[model samples]
Target: MSILVIGATGTIGSLITQRLADAGAEVKALVRQAGKREFPAIVTEVVADLTDVPSMRVALSSVRTLFLLNAVTPDEVTQALITLNLAREAGIERIVYLSVIHADRFTNVPHFTGKHTVERMIQSLEMPATILRPAYFMQNDRMVQQTIQDYSMYPMPIGSAGVSMIDARDIADVAVAELLRRDKASSALEPLTLELVGPQPLTGASAANIWSAALGREITYGGDDVAAFEGQLASYGPTWLAYDMRLMMTGIQRFGMQSTEGTVEKLQTLIGHPLRTYEDFVREAVAEG
Candidate 1:
C-alpha cells in the first residue's frame, strides 16, 4: 500500500520520507509546489497545501497510510482539522502523527496545546492511528548553532532540569516502522500513544558536557533565564513565537521533563534496535561539521 507523507521538507518529515523510500515502500511526498531537485527519486511528489482542501483531497486519494506532520503555525489546529476531515472522507486506513511529549498536560505551551488539539481529533476518527509524542528534539539545539559555535554554550532555556530529549531521526524511524510494518500484527494493533524519548535524560549541565566532550571544546549551560532567551529568539523571528517557546521551557522546568518509564522499551520494540543515545547524536553532529 502507498503512504502519503505531509510536511515532507521538515526536520522530522524529511527523514520519514527517506526512511520509507529506503524500506522499499511507495511514498507520495506532498508539497505545495513541485521543485524537481527537492525530493529523492523514489518519491512521487504531489502538490498539496494543508489549507487547500482540494489539493489535500487529491493527495489523500488512493493512499492507505498517512504520515501527518504539520509545522507549528498560528493556524495549525485549523489546518490539521481540515486535513483530518479530508483524510476521513478519502477513507484512509491509518495515520501516524508526530506530536510533542506530554502536549496534553502543558496547556500553557501554545504549540504543544495546538498539537494536543489535533491529536484528540485524530483519536476520534474511526481508523487505526498512532500518536507519537516525542520529547524535546535534540536537533532543536541546532537552531542556536551560532551561539554554540561562536560562544561555546548550549543556549537553550532547558535550565538545569533534566530532559529526556530525543533525536528526530529516531522519531522518523518509529513513523516509518508503524507505516510500513509494525511490531505487532494488524489484529493486535490499535490506537496507541508512544512517548518517544532517548535512552537517557540530560540536565543542562549534562547536555553541555556531552557536547563539550564530543566537540572537544569547553561548553557551558547558558542557565535559566526565560526572558533573556526569548529576547535572543525575538531578534531573529516573531516575538510571539519566542514568547510561546518561553512558556514551553518554563513549563518544562516547572514540571520535570525527564521520564522514560516504558518508552525506551517501546521504541526498541518498534525499531528492532536499542534507543539512540545523545552521545551518539553528539558524535554524529561533530563528525558532520
Candidate 2:
C-alpha cells in the first residue's frame, strides 16, 4: 500500500514517515521544497505546496492512504480543506488528520477554530478518517530550556488548569497505526476521533517542579501572564501568530487541554504501552543540553 504524508518535514510528521517506512510500507512525502533532507529508499519526496492544486494532485495521485498534518497557520483551514477535497476526488479513502484537543471548544483560537472546521468537513463528507486530537506538545517545553537553565524559571503560562501535554512521538506512533490499519483493511473503515493525551495533567508549577527535579536546581513557574508571553513571542516571530497563540493560551488558562475519563487507557491500548511522562521528557532534554 502507498501512503502520502503531508507536513512530512515537521516534527511529528517526520516521525510518522520514518515509522511507516520502517514498517516496510511505501511512503510519499508531500513537501514544498526538495533537497532539504533525505528519506529512506522506499520513500518518495513530492515537491508540492498546499495552495498549488496541480502539485497537490500529483502528490495525492496513486496513494491509498494519507496522513494529513496541517501546520498551525493563518490558512490552515484552507490548506486542509483543499488537500482533503483533492484526496477525496482522487479516490483516497483512508485518512488520519492531526487536529488539536478541544478543537471544538477553543473557538477563540484561530488554529483551533480552523481545525474544528476541518473536522466538521470530514464528518459531513462522510470520509473514512481518524482525527487525532492531541493535547499541548511536551516538546514545546524545549523552547523554555534556556530560560529554565539561565533564570531557573518555567516560562509557559499554561495556568492552573493543568494541561495533559502529550509527546509528539506518541502522536506519530498512533497516526502510523491508524494509517496502516486503514490501508490494509478490505474496505473503508468507520470514521473515528481519538483524544491523545499524556499520562497525567501538569500545571505550570508542576512542570517547573519536574524541571527542578531533573536539573537538580530550583525552577519556578513563571506565573500565568498571557500578555507577557505574547509580547515575548511577538518579539521573535510574526505578530499575528503571537496574537493567535495568546488567544490559545487564554483558552488554556480558562479551560486546560485536558482529557476525558478512559482517555489514557484508550490511548495505551492503541499505542501498546504506557504514555510517556513530562518528567522523562524534562530529564532527557536536560541531559542532552
Candidate 3:
C-alpha cells in the first residue's frame, strides 16, 4: 500500500515521511514547489497544491493511506473539505490527521477552529481515521534559537502553568505507526482520538532550566505578557494568526494544557517506544544545529 504525506517538507511531515519510508512502505512526498523535494531516495515526490482538487486527486489516486497536515490559512476549511472529499473518492482507506490540542474548546481562535472543522469532516467520512491532538510542541523552542544563542532567554505567555508539550518527531512516529497499521486486525482501532504528549508536563521555568542545562548556558524565562507577545507577533505575522496564538497561550495558562493520564502509555504502545522528554528534545535540537 502507498502512503501520501501532505506537507512532506514541513517539520512534522518530514519526520513522518522518513519513518514510513524506513518501515518499507511505499511513501509519496507531496510538495507544492518542485524545488522543495528533500526526502530520501526511496520516497517518490509528487507535485500538487492543496487548493487544486484535481491535482490532489491525481496525487492520491493510488494511495491507500494519507497523512494530512496543513498550515493555517484563510482557505483552510475549503482546502480540507476538498481534500477529504478527493481522498474518499480516490478510495483511500485511512487518514491520520495532525491537529492542535483543545481545538474544540478554543472556538475564538481561527486556526484551532479550522482544525476542529476538519476533524468533524474527517469523522463524517467512511474511511478509518485517527485524529491526533497534540499540545504545544517542544520543537517551538527552535524558533527562539537566536534568542537562546545571544540573550539566553525564552519568551512565552504560558506563565508558571505546566504544559504537556510534545516533540514533533514523536508525533510523527505515532502517525506513521497508525498509517502502517490501518489494515491490521484490531477491534479497538477505528475512529480513535489520541491525545499525544511528551514524557512530562513542564512549566516555563522548568523548560528554561532544561534548555539551560542542555545548552550549557544560562537561560531565563522572559515574561508572561500575552498582550505584549501578541503585539510583537502581529508585527511579523498576520493579525488573525497572531491573535489566535496569543489566545491559545492565554487558554493554556488558565486551563492548563497538560494531557490526561495514559497519554504517554498509549502513545508508547503505538510507537513501540517511550516518548521523548523536553530535556532529550533540547539536546538533540542543539546537536543538529
Candidate 4:
C-alpha cells in the first residue's frame, strides 16, 4: 500500500519520510514543489502545497496511509481540517498525526489545543488514526547554537523543572511503525494515542551539564524568565510564535515533564529498543561538529 507524507521537508516529517523510504516502503511525499528542492530518488514527490487544498487530491491518489504533521502557524488548524476532509474523501484508510504531549490538558496553548481539536474531529469522523504525542524536542537547543558555542551556556527559560524531551529521530521510527502496521483496529475505531519522549526526566540544568560534558566545557542554564525568553525567541520567529512557545515552557514549568511506564512500553512495542537519551543525542551532535 502507498503512503502519503505531509510536511515532508520539515524536521520530524523529513526523518519520517526517509525512514519509510529506507525500509523499502512505497512512499509519496506531498511537498510544495518537487523541482524547487531535491528529495530522495526512492519516493515519489508530488507538488502539493497545504496553502492550496485543491492540489492535495493528486497527492492522495493511490495512497492508503497519511503521516500528518502540521507546524505552529496561524493557519495550522485550518490546514489540518482541510487535509482531514480531503484524506477521508480520498478513501485513505489510516492517518498518523504528530501532536504535542498532553494536548488534552493544555487547552490554551495554540499548537496543543489546535491539535486536540483536530484529534476530536478525526474521531468524530470515524477516521482510522494513531496520535503520537511527542515531548519537547532535544534539538530545540539548536536555536541557541551561538550561545552554546560562543558563550558556553544554554539560553532558554526551561526553569529548573525536569522535562521528558524526545529525539525527533525516535518519533520518526515510531511513526513508520504506525503507518505500516496493518493488524490495527478498524478505521472507525477510537485512535490509538502514544507518547514519544526521552528515557528520563531532565531539567535545564541537567541538560546543560550533559552538553558541557559532551563538549568539555561548563554550559550554564538560562534562568526562568518568560518575558526575556520570549524576547530571544522573537528574534528567530514572529512575536506570536515566541509567545506560544513561552506558554508551552510555562506549562512545563508548572506540570513537570514526567512520563509513565506505559509510554516506554509503547516505544518498545514499536521499535523493540530502549529510547535514546539526551546524552546520546548530545554526543552525536558534538561529534558531527
Candidate 5:
C-alpha cells in the first residue's frame, strides 16, 4: 500500500511525505518539477502536472492513498477536479485533502471557495476520503516578517477576533497517519471532514504579544482598516491575489477565523503526542529567521 503525495515539494506536503516515509510506508511524491525536488532517498519521485490528466494518471498508478494539496492559483478548481477524477479512475482508495476552515461559509473568497469546491467533489466521489479543514495557520505569520522586523508590529485588519491557528506540522502529522494506516475500517473509510486547529484561540493582539516575546521587542497590532490593508496588499502582491486576500480578510473580520472545536486532540491521537503550540511555532519561526 503506497501513498502518493501531490504538491510534495511544498511546506505542508513535504512534511507529510517525510512523516509517511518515516513511518515505513512506501511513499511516492508527485512533483511538477521532479529534478528540482530533494526528497528522502527512500521515497520515489514522479514528475506530473495536475492539469495534465495523462501525466497525473501515470503518477497515480500503483498508489493506494493520495494526500492532495495544491499551490494557490486561479486554475486550482479545475486542476483539483481533474486530479480527483484521475485518482479515482486509477483505483486510489483513499484521499486526504488539506482544506481551509469555514470553507463552506466563505464562498466570497476565491481561495476558500476553490477549496470548498474541491471538498464537494471529493465528497461526491466513491473513494473513501477525509477532508482536514485547518484554521488560519500560525505559519501565516511568515507573511508579516518584514513588518515585524521594521516596526516591531504585526498588522491584521481583523480587529479583536481570535483565531484557532494550527501549526502546519500538526496538519501534516494527521495526514500521514491517515495515509499510512492500512486497517482503516470501512465505516471509518466513509468520507469525513475534520476541523484541525491549535490548542487554543488567540486574538490578533495576543498574537502580536507572542511575537513581541519571541523577538525580544514590543510588537503591537496596527490597524483595522480593511480597505487600506487591501490597497496595501494590491500594491505589493498580484492583482488577483490581492483581491482574494481582501475578500478573505473581510470574511475573517466578519466571521472570525477561529474553529469552535479543538483539532489538537485528533492531531495528538494520530501522532501519539501533544500538538505543538502557537508559542512553539513562533519560537521556531524566530529561530529560523
Candidate 6:
C-alpha cells in the first residue's frame, strides 16, 4: 500500500518523500495543489488539505503508513489532530510524527506546545507511531546564510548554552526507516519516541568560528538579541510569527536544546553512522554560495 506524506513540499518533507520513493516505497504526496512542486514520477500526488475533512479522507485512504509533518502555523495542532483522527478512522496504523526536541519543556512557545499536545494525543490514543523529536535543524542556517556571507556575522541568537542541531538529510533517512519499519511489520509495533540530535551541541560563537574557517575570513557571533532578530523577521513575515519565533529563541537561550543522555549513541546505532557535523554543513553552504 502507499504511504501518505503530509507537508510534502517542505524542505524536510520533500527530502523524506524523495527518499521513500527512491527506496521503492509507494508514496502519496498530500499537496494542497496539484503540480505545485515536482516529485519523482513514481510518487502518487494526492491533492488534499489537512483542515478539509473530505479531501483528507481521500488522502488517507489505502495508505499503510503516514508521515505526519505540518508547517508551524496558527492552527498547527488542529491540523495534526484532524489528520490523526482521519488516519485512525481510515484504519491507517503506522505513523511518523516530526516533533521538536524539548517540545514539552518549551511550553511557552506556541509551536512547541502544539507539537507536545499532538504527541500526548498520539500516545493517549495508543496510535502505533514513531515520534521523532529532532533538535534545531542545521538547515535553518540557510535562512541566515546571506547574512553570514555578506555581513560576516551569524545572527540566530541561539545563545551560549548551545543547540544540538541535526541535518535535514539525517532526519529524512530516519523518518523513512521508521515509516518502513512499522508499515511492513507483521503486526502493529509498539509506539516509540526518538530524540534526533547532532554529534554535538554548537554555541553561537562556535558556529561563527566554523563559518570563519569555511570562508577563510573572520566572522563574528551576532549576540543573542532576539528582539533585533524578531524585528528583522517581522519586516518580511507576519508580526505574530516573528514574536512566536522570538519566544522560541528565548526558551532555547534559557534551557539549552541539548540532547538527553545517550541520545547520540542511540541515534548513531539506529542510522549506523555518526551524525553529520555543523562544520561540514557550514563548509558546504559556503562552497555552494
Q: What residue runs in model 6 are displaced by over 4 Å at the alpha carbon?
A: none
> lDDT of all the models against the reference?
0.83, 0.93, 0.83, 0.82, 0.81, 0.92
Candidate 5 ranges beyond 4 A from true positions: 182-188
Ten residues in a row with the worst lDDT in model 2?
33-42
Candidate 1: how large is its RMSD?
Answer: 2.0
Report the C-alpha lDDT of model 1 over 1-289, residue by residue, as the tens digit.
5789988988888999998888778889988878833767889998888998878888889887888888888898898889888988987757888888889779988899999998888776645788888888889877666678789998887866678888888888888888775323464257878888888878888889998998789999899899998998899999889899899989888775665578788788988888778898888877877
TM-score preference between candidates 1 and 5, better one: 1
Residue-level lDDT tens digits of model 3 in 198-271:
88888878888887998898899877889988998899889888888898888787766778888789889888
- Taking all chains together, each candidate's TM-score versus the true structure is 0.94, 0.99, 0.93, 0.94, 0.93, 0.98
Candidate 4 local lDDT, 31-149, one digit each (tens) = 78666545678888888877686788777778888889998899999999998898889987688988888898777789889999998898787778888888888888776666787
Of 4 and 6, the candidate ahead on TM-score is 6
lDDT of 2 by residue, 21-116 (tens): 999999998888896677888899999999899999988999999999999888888999999999999999999999999999999889999999
Task: Give the poorly placed runs of model 1, Cα more than 4 Å off.
Answer: 182-189
The runs of at least 3 residues in candidate 3 whose Cα sits more than 4 Å from the true structure, single-residue gaps closed, are: 183-189, 215-217, 287-289
Model 3 poorest 10 in a row by lDDT: 181-190
Is 3 or 5 the stronger prediction by lDDT?
Answer: 3
Candidate 6: the clashing residue pairs are: none
Q: Looking at candidate 6, what is the lDDT of residue 40?
A: 100
Which pairs in model 5 have colliding backbones? Answer: none
Which portions of model 2 show Cα errors greater than 4 Å?
A: none
Segments in model 4 whose C-alpha atoms lie over 4 Å from true places:
183-190
